[model samples]
Target: MKPQLAHSRDPEMKSSLQELLIYMIFLTDLGILTFGMVSTDMFYLNKVMSSLFLDTSMSETGNTNFKSIESVDDFWKYAEGPFLDGLYWDASDIRSSIAVNGTTRHIYYENLLLGVTQVRQLKVRNNTCSVYPAFRAFMKECYGPYHYLSEDKEHFGLKNGPEWWYFTSQSLSPWHQGLVGLYSSGGFTFTLPKSKNASIDKLTYLKEKGWLTRGTRVVFIDFSMYNANVNLFCVVRLVLEFPATGGVLPSWQIYSVKLLRYTTYYDYFLAFCEVIFCLFIFSYIIQESIKMKILKEEYIKNAWNWLEILLLLLSLLAIVFNIYHTVEVSSLLEYLLSNSFTYPDFYLLALWQTRCNNMISVNFCFTCIKIFKYVRFNKTMTQLSSTLSRCAKDIIGFAVMFIIIFFAYAQLGYVAFGSQTDEFSTFQNSIFTQFRIMLGDFNFASIEQANGILGPIYFITFVFFMFFVFLNMFLAIINDTYSKVKAEFSVMPSREFEISNRIREGYRKALAKRKLKRKSTSQNAILYAVRQDRRDKE
Candidate 1:
């Protein structure tokens, strides 16, 4: 039954209550979406990738001949560090593993591509030097003008290896390829014949060629590590874009992945739920579009409306990608199932699926933000909203000033300590390292040691301005606005939600009707008793 609104006279209140009620129905769909998120991306995909985790440097796992990388000093140490170490297996192992005892009918593979499109010698030092330490052997020493970690030779022991490499651009990307060279795949050191007059290190070679990133900066550690008979393909792809400084532009993706199913029952059920969720989003979009048409300018003006549009766009992209991947996977699998000898090239599909998951995460965040719009009428929430909006202009001004000073300090630290300290090795690293210093993860001794006089001066200025002055000023602005909002809300009496008021009104009327019926029944019983008493007296 449609409930009556308490503030019937206020048409605006009535309309808002109606809208809130409709939104509640749409909110039910989030339950399924959340389940899919936790089940698939958070747990399931991690499990699949984890199952493939191994130390590629070890003999048990296949090896990589890393051509795309610039440095080889700590390559052995790196091939085993964080995340899974990618593997390279011959096609025979892949085929034999799946056909004999494998529950997995098919397998797919992808190369572990590392580095930005533009590879630099400095970045090679930055990425590796301090990241993977062997022990108390003191790995941070690598973060120096000189790679001093080599002095701790007992810990840094894959010692007898290439001090340099040559970059030969691959006119072909080896997606259908795995590692070459010997076991442990160690020979990246490019050597010239003894007849030659001169030899070049990796750094000298890149400099002479005039550094380019496209093919040389990246390493594709390919994997066909189809574990004896177990099924999995695992690798990582990551790049941080700096815009004039960075933006991650897309490159061609390889279709070298096979979709996995842990259990057929859950897979089918979750897939069905995904279809339902997508359909609900489509319906919700149509409803919101109608409202958008009715309230054109106002709709566009509202930030919450834009969030809805973004959520819908992300959701739409995910849905379209999912459909395309499904069709493509099915077509490929159909051919593969028949032509059992053929290796699968579904890597491109896997890459896009991962990207799709990232968008799902964005959609989830926007969906959560949209919740505030529906709950804005709440007294506490209204105060918070008012406080933020009131100080928004001031905050914006503060933010601009903050960025200028922050960049100034970051650049200063980068230019000063970048040569000797890992924390300030790159402009971006300096920016983030400054943030860490703010958060109290600072290494003061290192900062001071980077340069005795300038180091201390730079830090003192950064702290005094950023932490002591700007931070407190920003906090004061927020505190002042909050106090004003609190006072304003306190002066105006609060009303319960219109939907809650309607439900209470229905409950009160039902209670009154029940009491009236009981009263009439009691009177009727008393009259019957009185007539019985009169008959006994006669």
Candidate 2:
């Protein structure tokens, strides 16, 4: 991270102070915004809580308590409400209260979900006491002797306990309910209680806990009405939970986690970019101002090298940010998979949404600076020419391969789809798909629709070309060419000098060949004359 000077006649430290000052002003404004974000975090939490409460029809119970608890102790004290007394058990009490008596009071029916047979309805009551385990023996306590750490809450809460976590969505029809979307180490896998119809001899077994009869229209079952004496209950409880559910469960506090996540990454990325910009400014200033005796070539080369390395790192950081976003998106996909309703293509539409835009901007900045480096250093045209020639050769090779494949696929597509559908029936549709893949605009839905409308012949053909042929070829080319681009500027030279050297070499070779020919002819003539004289004397 050391700042080095530029190599020049005066090497006046590249005075970028003005530029640095402007950046500092901008950063100061940004700092205010960042501070505001932190300060408003509580406000965002309240907003999320309000939204969730509205979604669950809890707003009518009373004015929503969107107050932020500044600490875990505050959360615990609030949880001592009468409503939680019946649901959770402390670890000491868990061993004894293997079974609990609970009457299902009322049930409301919802029909939005697709194939799910049953969904649970959360009951509300002002007088009902909420059950909670004592901290000393709470099975959900993070630091307890027998408690398991809860991913959602840092401290013990009803959500941290197996009883509450499992019941949260157990009876809900997957079709109507939204599965919490939280990114995890891998794709999502959730386990629920074994089916009631499962054989008794099966390892998984449960007893009917209780039933709530709201009317003839709806019946809610409280599965905790009965408890089985088995050592495998904890395993069964663990199975009911989602593997990818790392954030706060979505009941009340999930939005807080989501907002915090977005805020954290967003600020970090912005900060990283700012730091890089600062370093760049500082280096430029030092290069212009410092006048230490250093070899001009060595100094310039080193400074440029440092710039290149930093630019590469910036690109890498942007890539990681994009990847993290992609992971978040994949988690959202898991939620959709768990539910049955078809939502509009929000994720697809938002794919390039801010996340991709930031990455693209970062890449553009890096590339612009890189090109600027060559111009600023006044690299010779001959070097530029050589670089362009190599690039041209590569382009030609790639074009040839692409054209051959395009034609081949287009022809095959015509044969397969021409009679069946208008889309891929002609060579043009095949070419369009190829173009889309190249531009990273390929759409699975459109492709599938084309196949469905046309037939299996085109589907199989296009799939083969898209996956086995195009994907591999494109990736190989890009991966192979990356190093070439990185090394290109180092070996640039003047075109005029190269041509002159070639001409001189040709002239020297021609003159040497002529001299050799003349020597051989004279030697032959001399031998012939000597032979003739000998014959005459004899």
Candidate 3:
């Protein structure tokens, strides 16, 4: 049956209007709820999809095993073919049947294999060897147990030992393997098998002496053998593949690169969103600076806008790159070829592409912006002598303050961290770690691990500096500088104005002097005429 539509012009249409309004409200609420639910589901689905294989070589199979799987056909059959869509991945290598309680349960173990599933205990069994425990041992063997955050001894207790994060690396090529050390800005290191020394450059002589063969199995250890003190973050493994040609040229030999996912994708998604928001902020700043009429210094404003534009453009590029990598699986080859001349494995590329989109790319763009703003733009001060002295004073004042803060934090870190911290115990480390803390990344967990007496004090001091002193000081300096610069520009006349005023004054004075001279000459001529007339009459 068709429902009758009521005309709103009639007074009797009140009932129909109320019903329509109520239906509209209900529909809006339902739409909002549906959208929210769909967004959440899509986010989770993206995470799952991104974790799939994009690395060229997905595992850390030994050279011998990798050699056995040589040839494109065998490679597909043994490794690539197994993980393709619709093929059942045989967990048979890592899976074991264990007796739990009275029955047997299938358990899959997570060893050192890269691009594989994580280990999870589905059920508990009596006298059963769960895969998790063995996986932990295997992890210790493959990737050393180093941690950025140490446990709190007073709270968690010493008997339990230190809580740590494990790091690992997998080889992509049969002979050439790479290691990446993770740090705030830690760089990468490549470890080549003795045979691949011909392909890799800058390898230590000791590595060359080790065994040189195509099939020899070699472990590229990250930590120093002489010292048990392992780096808190060092490249466990990074696999890069290059062309099969021998070339000394720096640009030609480089191939593809990849990094593993130590953290989740949401961490990156949130970061990418942050990059967009940051670019928005830069755009807003540019608009605001343009609106600031009081600032007569056009160069400064232009420089600032240029930086803002550069940052916004870089950020947009990063966003587009991330979106492309996220959506298309084949773009990795293009990215590697353009940037580093290497085509990273699919999984490595996926990890690299995802990580690039998330934090690394954003951070890189941010750092570049900061460098240009502080160092490059500030150098322009040298070109103008009037502002040079003031600029020098400001620079020196900031440098001294920075030095004092750095030393104070270094001392605090040294006293607080003591021997418990590796890669951050020395004076240099104390300074670096202090800088990280100053950036609001102070880890209380690491602070609680120090010697009972000094640990708490150090932790407190560091936290106070980071959260209270540094953060507040940073903002305060900006506020103060803004006030000073605004006051100067607002009160003082511009250089062009002063020059124009002087020129007009000179012209006015010249005209007035000319008029005075003309009047004097005219008066003198009249007196001479009068004197001549008197003489003629006499």
- The best candidate in terms of lDDT: 1
Candidate topping TM-score: 1
lDDT of 3 by residue, 1-538 (tens): 1123222222333333443444344334323322321233334323322232222233444231222443323333322222232112234453433222211111122111121111100111122222467476554322121122311112111222111111232533222222221121111223222122222332233233322112111222121000011101111221121111211111101112222211356545545545545555466557655655555566455655565556556555555655655554445435634643221334433344444444444544454344322222121332232344445666577668867866876876676575677535677777777667666666667666656667677767657865687667656766666566656755654322122333467689999999999999999999999999999999
lDDT of 1 by residue, 1-538 (tens): 1135434435665666677776665565555554453332334433444344322233443343222212433233333332222322222554343332121222223222111112211112322233454553653333222122211112111334332343332322222211111111111222221111121243345344433232122232222222222233333332111111222221222222334533357657767767777777888799888998899888888887778888888888877877787687578658756754333444455666666766777777677667667655556777788898999999999999999999999999999999999898889899999998787789988889999999899988898899999999999999999998888767775554544565578689999999999999999999999999999999
Better of 2 and 3 by TM-score: 3
Give the CA lDDT, 0 to 100, for residue 191 in model 2.
Answer: 21
The per-model lDDT (C-alpha) reads 0.52, 0.37, 0.38
lDDT of candidate model 1 versus the reference:
0.52
Order of models, best lDDT first = 1, 3, 2
List runs of model 2 lying over 4 Å from the truth: 1-385, 389-405, 413-538
lDDT preference between candidates 1 and 2, better one: 1
